[model samples]
Target: MKPLSTIVQAITGCLLIISCNHTPRARTVQVQSSANESVKDYPSHPKTAEELRQELAETEAADPAGMLLISGTMQENKILIQKPDLFHHSKYATDGYMISGIIRNKASIAPFKDAIVRVTFYTETRTELDHKDYPVYKYVLAQQVTPFELKVYPPESTKDFNMEVVSATAIRN
Candidate 1:
């Protein structure tokens, strides 16, 4: 029989792999469903565009980040992480590391400019260590990609990290 500790480690590793493998499409579907529910629960309809704007403003005031994204016209972006490399930079800080990756615009034709890309570092136990957001270049053109490099100076106690394109302004051509 396998040792208890070894079995536990294997199970933990499997769970981590499963959690990290969520596709962006699945996440978008989830967000759309949740947004649908929230919109269904909104009390009234606005007669004018200005009133619609006011309603959105009030909703955003209630849930600053989520409501704006849900009510906005922007579509979900597929920011693919390509060739991500993380390396330890210092011996003193347990989470001292540098990460470099290429973020590709996989699923959009609507050009986005100056989007905020965020990385959240987590410990082995899945505890949040640190998070930082950086702006992409002036524009991430349609069907193209951008390379980025960032260092986590004081990563606290990170063992893993997740990168995301959190927010971006979509521009019409």
Candidate 2:
């Protein structure tokens, strides 16, 4: 019986060793590339300030409204709050300040979406009272103009407010 048990153990060990020594066969899987034919990769090169300025000028001229440029790489202060209408309103149920305005993307080609339009309320001494931000609609397409409305509940010392584009985020699909 002892010899039989030893033989069984040795057989189990040999089976384990055989299984462990087996190597998986290499697989020849075909991979598909996801490169788009319409998109081309251009080599990057450094340019002088004058060259950059000239290129910017050309871009600006080609698309004066800047509706077709790269949205993410646009420089700061490219968003313009055009013809903002700010006024204080008081009603029986609610009393606060109202801000309505149009935000325009001054980019040469980039479109902005989900832009944050901020209005900062201040007192007579320009003391910060309250600040509120309103988000622009779905897609403020390239060279596109979008309107925003915000109702701010100002503090008692609120006397005036200023509106500006806090930040504009570009939409990515």
Candidate 3:
């Protein structure tokens, strides 16, 4: 009888020979294209910024206040809050805190109005103290920026605050 090692080597050699002898067939795929097809026919490329702006303007001109509602995520993504200025009032009669910032509309096709800004107040230890939502009644055109302000009374422990555009009314017309 053949030794175990010899038998194993023979089996391995047979496998190697069999594998080496069997070759996979090469496949060539042919793609058909029409010479008459124009770039406009595909319409797969993205629109240019200028083209988008023009389209937005035309839509707005045709239908002002056509967009009644916009999603919160869409507003958060498109309406950006920039250059926030915070002020503290000494008198209690006036709201204790004032926040002013720029609302930039990054949406290519929709204008936004009446944005809801969410202010989250935090303590020195980074613990959240309170949050408030303020509405800014302003019209922000697409690719434009507008200023807004909010007055609120925050907890005395508030050491820092963050503001974000939570939602807005989109103007489709």
Candidate 4:
């Protein structure tokens, strides 16, 4: 048998040679689904400001009235008619009902113009009798309120009335 010191040295030299010959490579792991298929990860690209503006312009040009309609519908909830008062007045020898209220725009971004208020007339039993659309040709800024008074000739059986904003043109500047 070899001497103990020499045998230890020989073993150490062998281990150093083996370690120097072996190099580590990066390993890539791929996830697999239950169907034995590899799952791919896709990167998402977001729209830029210019692209969004172009798209909006195209949409507006395609359907101007439709765009207004959509915008009005989306903003209907944001428009509020507050402090409404219903009364009758003998003006111009006509018995007409007058509705006065404040139109409040709760939107924080867009100002509205040419808002239409729909006054729904109802009977004493809470049944709807008729509805009239009153055009308010006024500009109402965002987070602002405007006062409006409209004269309507509702049916004789109109005992109750409710007012709400039906449509408006959204001015995005």
Which candidate's lDDT is highest? Answer: 3
Candidate 4 lDDT: 0.65
Q: Give the per-residue lDDT of model 2 (tens digit) for 48-137.
A: 887776666455434422342221111112223343446633323344545556666666445556666566768898989888776655
Order of candidate numbers by lDDT, starting with the best = 3, 4, 2, 1
lDDT of 4 at 68: 29
Per-residue lDDT value at 113 in model 2:
65
Q: Where's the lowest-lDDT run of ten residues in candidate 1?
A: 67-76
In the predicted model 2, the residue pairs found to clash are: 66-107, 66-108, 66-109, 67-109, 67-142, 67-143, 68-109, 69-109, 69-110
Measured with C-alpha atoms, the lDDT of residue 146 in candidate 3 is: 80
**Residue range 1-173, candidate 4, lDDT tens digits:** 46998999999999999999998998999965697666686648788887777666554434322322211111111223344447643323344655666777655445678877777889999899998887988877656777766767778787777777777776655
Cα displacement (angstroms), candidate 1, residue 140, comes to 1.0
RMSD vs true structure, all candidates: 27.1, 17.0, 14.3, 13.0
Off-target runs (Cα >4 Å) in candidate 1 are 1-96
Encode model 3's per-residue lDDT on 1-173: one tens digit a residue: 56998999999999999999999999999977798775456557899988888886666544433432232211111222344347642322332555666776665567777877777889999899998887889897877778766666778787777777677766655
Model 4 stretches astray by more than 4 angstroms? 1-94
In model 4, state the lDDT of residue 91: 29
